[model samples]
Target: MKKKFLGLLIFITTYASSQTYTTNFNVNTNNKDIKSIVDIWQSYLKTNSKEYWNTAETKDLKNFNILNIEGVINPSLMNWNFSNLILSVNLFSEDSYLIKSIFEGENKSVFAITNVLAKKENGNFKLSNYLFDYTKNWRSHSSENITYFYRPDYILNVEEVSQAEKFYSELCKTFNLKSEKLTYFIAKDCDNIYDILGYEYIFSKGMSKECGYYEIQNNYIFATEKAGANHYHEITHFINKFYPNANYLLLTGVSAYLSGEKAHFGKPLIYHIKRVNEYLEKNKEISLSKPFDFYKLDENTNPQYVIGGLLCDLIIERQGKNGLIEAFKNTKSDEEFLQFLQSKVLKKNENLNDVLRKKIKEISKTDEFPNRLKN
Candidate 1:
């Protein structure tokens, strides 16, 4: 009976020591002992089970779910396997630490940076909140005004960054606009983009694969390909901040005009212009008068973008740059923009609808029109 009791006591001691839990350390008294707390958090990350996570604080559980979905489950669904976990911790505040975790995977991997906030209650540190900065894991390169974040495997070249900055400056000068610091996020591929943006939100919106997208709210540009890097098209969207309430048609039109239509595809502007002309020729029933209604047209059949570009070009040519700027500043809707063009930009007696079609036909006949490919 004595030997049995001794053996049971040893087993319990060993098991209790092996189990990891969060450590509470008083900042004023035990500042140097914070490593112990970090160690416990790291151990919990590696060894904790789903049941343990389920019972954890709601904020921590929510963060864990985000990391699991984006970092683990989504990758697994895409045939990637993750391993080789690396965790780095830095003290953020008296009760919080910043944790960065990088995992190596067979197909692809993720690096996650999250702020782990804790509270001391009953002599134990309990997780309170987790605020995540998804881009923290990306490698960053910056100029004076622009910060570009990219994957480790794919990095932006110095020339590309320099050119992007130069173009931004030029756009500011051209538009008489002020410049602001910009952040660019370049994904490895389309799949990786879905990782940056939560899978459900992107897929649910029916967003098709494009080279890049400009997020106006966040002031960030998300790109899937190298061509998407520093494109004037996306930059134009940002510069349009000067005229927040401008007509959508005028807004996109000016961007299309200044940036050119083939900005993403690397073809000359003429390539897209010609494609639009061919589209117009094939479908004569379509009128450029209702350029705003071009959204109703099929994606392949839509000539609105090219039409807008040409119309903007015409406005700049006839009304001058100052006139175009005035229109952008004053026009609030598509109807207002159209009326502005009729009353101010174009000749007073000429019909507004005929001018655009006539210009399209004349430009289509020019040698500058691209004939090799449709798009």
Candidate 2:
């Protein structure tokens, strides 16, 4: 069965590769016409009229491949309010051009750079491709179940990839969730991951060198440097698809608990509980009752993982795993879901916040908390 699956995978990839478009062009970054062309395109974005596009067109407007080029540029540019834009053009050939632009937006204060490919038809340059730079220089690999994109020199091991596939499948079954086709991007390191994702994007900001993230919208997992014992942390986020409205506390805490990575560099859960207890003893200001605003906190300063993990474990102990799953599926919003957890799942007659703090101290006494430092 495995051999047959491998063969089918090979056939699909080969066929897909054969169908991709081929283009011939020389890359020249120092072209004067490129800036003029980009300025016209910017005007088109600002005015939302074909007249600006027509002004930069080398061929009939109808013949320009707008579909192919749109993917390379920011889809949000259609709404305007972009500023501090810098444009660079690379002449792929006498007739083909690749234009790169970097700019910022007011909405999220996001910084983005995009590449647009243009080809000359009948002595006019027509847009051919527009996309993020990460889409370029990527090589694809597949296991029986998952497809991953990686840099040329940073391929993941086939056995490791296969293991991740099996782990994800088993998790779906465990959670009683339907599986989706998973894609992984094995970046050389965390910096490479940031480059693929724009630097100014909120998700890309404040991340440490060891951290990689899963993009829920794109259905892709990015891991830096190492795959690290099945990527169970990110996979947990992917598998908990039922809880679309769950708060970051529940989401990050549950994954941190299950993955065991947040526990003192992947130490046992009790160790993390003890660490949080210790942290709380020194710093009395951090409150578990409030929602964790990740945007305000630095990447490494998250207490949510430790406190949240212990809370999740408590929920499982008192209410059972199905009870936790029920809370996830039924909750309408972040606030409502957290209230449900306190009222329904925790079910303590006393103040739940005080109860959780006491529970953390109690759990710190467990044998799982190591005596000698593992590090």
Q: Kindly list the per-residue Cα lDDT of model 1 for residues 165-196, writing each as its tens digit.
A: 88788778777677887878787665565556
Give model 2 RMSD, 1 decimal: 12.9
Worst 10-residue lDDT window for candidate 2 reads 14-23
* Model 1 TM-score, all chains together: 0.60
TM-score per candidate, in order? Answer: 0.60, 0.65
Worst 10 residues of 1 by lDDT: 1-10
Count backbone overlaps in model 1: 0
Per-model CA lDDT versus the true structure:
0.54, 0.53
Best by TM-score: 2
Name the runs in model 2 displaced over 4 angstroms.
1-84, 92-99, 105-139, 198-207, 262-272, 291-301, 365-375
Assess the local accuracy of residue 206 in candidate 1 as a C-alpha lDDT between 0 and 100: 30
Superposed Cα deviation of residue 127, candidate 1 (Å): 13
Candidate 2 structure lDDT: 0.53
Could you give the C-alpha RMSD of every candidate to the true structure, in order shown? 17.3, 12.9
